[model samples]
Target: MTSPADLIINWDVARSTASRLVPPGPSLSPAAAAREVADVRQAAAEAVGYVHTITGLSAAEGLGEDQRDVLVVDRPGWSAANTESFRKLLRPALDAVAEKKPQLVSEGSSAQVFGSAAAGAELGGILAFLSANVLGQFDPFHSSEHAPGGRLMLVAPNIVEIAKQLNVDRSDFRLWVCLHEQTHRVQFAAAPWLRDHLMSSISTLSSSTLGRADGLPQRIVEAVKSLRQEMGQQKVSDQHDAAAGVPARNRLLEVLQTPEDREIMSHLTAVMSLLEGHANVVMDAVDDSIVPTVKTIRRRFEQRGKNRSPLEKIVRKLLQLDVKAAQYRDGQKFVGHIVETIGMERFNTIWDSPEHLPSEEELHNPDTWIERMGYTPKG
Candidate 1:
């Protein structure tokens, strides 16, 4: 076991071998960068050091190996221009969910939620391309926090470009994704079973220390380039043979989820779907009040189809979890129906306790959503 003192923060572990995730802010001359640093200091003092600063989005290679804990990055390149579009896609959902759980924004008497749970400082950063190195896979992240356990990692999602790909305007979509990551932080803080379930599942698959390796095999690189070439000419089909890609990883996930893990994963996925779904519902409800200029910016990626990463395609091929376009539709429909059946206020009240959320059985049936609430909705 690598001791805390010996755990080396290797730059190779960063998403790209060439660099580290940079902090926000434009490229600066030494003098200009100095002034920006001062501003960062001022912001840090106001918060509990929850947020960190970065120079570029790619400086992940530069992180201190010894550094650990939840880091909320206050980026330098932040722009209303960049974020505004997503607000449109996400406003309806955010507004509705907010209406559902008003106290979440308030109710300070209870504990606060962590911004994210990550294996490293980088888990939540915005990624033009996602990778296990950056967003630590749930199947592998684990530890014994009980004994100086670094088992739990808190991370925040910095998904600036996600809505652009989805082909939806940003307003609501960005906020909702943020909320989903935020949901993890919330789940970790509020649901003890959640942390256990996630960590246990991760540990069962691999170990506490699945650090990044040096590089991919040369053959795999050649293979991937070859595949991309062939793919341009051929429509993907079952016979298209993705297994030909190099560095092929085992998709079955060796560690099977225990009944406890399954229960937790199902609920967590459902809660995430609900959280995101509710955000969409909220957006649709109060969309009349949504700002105008924000609507002008179209970040449209919603209907573009499933995230088409090689890893995603591989998983779908292996597990047949097609992740329908309507996957989220059910959640949206479920929440909307609930709000229509019971008044929004009553619909919102269920979030007061975890028990009020639906079970897997309910998640399966859009029509049975209200029935799962153990009562028919009041027309």
Candidate 2:
């Protein structure tokens, strides 16, 4: 059996490459850095307190605790942290690939070495793109060695850069960002089962996909054919439209082939949509008295998404970040619709178990989930 660490050779190269690709933000003086860190820490704590009360979910019940430390890091630090997290998350799948290596390659062959290099390079490029864009992430897989359990990470530089670009008040914007991330912290903390559920889904999907390597070539061919057919149907003017031109059935979907994989992916999508949408809801629902600039911040943030440069737009499509925007919008709408129809208490029941989660279709049609859950709106 191959070790997970052996799957990606020269990960340092990936880290360095990503760091290089990320543009540097204006440097903070020593005092400024210290102050920023202090502000984020305070804001994060307050945000958590607000979320706990607003969601009506006790932190002790959800995560078995009330608070987690928040770590503020620059782009390079954030990228490095995420790279380690991804390694942990992807290890099981990588191990599955290693188990199949003998059948895929002969002893003393250099193919494994070459493949690792390519994989590492691709992983690096993807991380590089993400490091430049992600504002904050509450990593469930964060290493305890880094801190007690895993602390919430706020990418200080990215937050500062975005706030400056939007011309928003830094203090309010900082707290706003913290609120969203802190909500994620509260989510996994409060719903103790969520971390395990997400890990299981990811592990199963990865192992299933990697274990089917023998059929990968055919799957790729089919995916290419599907893409071509999709392209052929689109008008010339629509050819470059990222959202419409690219069909949802891509290489990963084609490779996973089995009904089991599809089901797993659907579950994963639904859960993520809930998590993301819930965060957005919590962030927006903050009292205007607390986050006075919330409306302006949200409006400009939406405009920022619509006003990306041509190159940035292409990069977003390639990095699958475009799907992220859809997730936010679609998920927000879904959660909002359900909550409006059945109330937050009924909507919160979806988090009770995996079965209660919405399907892809149910995400758009709240009635399906409402009916299936047998929930009736208050008279």
Per-residue C-alpha lDDT of model 2 across residues 1-379, encoded as one tens digit per residue: 7454554444666677777776776689989888887887777767766777667766523332334456788888888887778778888777777667654333335775676667767777777777767888889876575444466888887887899999999889988998889878877766667777788899999888888878888877876777667556755343453544434544345443678998888777777888898889888788678888988998999899898899889988787777776678778999888878988778777777778878888987879999999988777
Q: Which residue pairs does candidate 2 place in steric collision?
A: 62-189, 62-190, 63-189, 63-190
Q: What tens digits encode model 1's per-residue C-alpha lDDT throughout 1-379?
A: 4212111221113233212443332344777545434433232222111111111112222222222322333232221111222232233433343344444333222321221112112322333123211211111122334312222121222333343445454444433333223233333333345444444434432221122112325445655666566656656554433544311221112122235545555665576566556544543433223323224322233333344778757745554344333445666777777767765555654554667776656765644656656666675
By lDDT, the best candidate is 2
Per-prediction TM-score, please? 0.41, 0.88
Q: Give the TM-score of candidate 2.
A: 0.88
Q: What are the Cα lDDT values of the candidates?
A: 0.37, 0.75
For model 1, state the Cα shift of residue 348 in Å.
1.9
Candidate 1 CA-lDDT value: 0.37
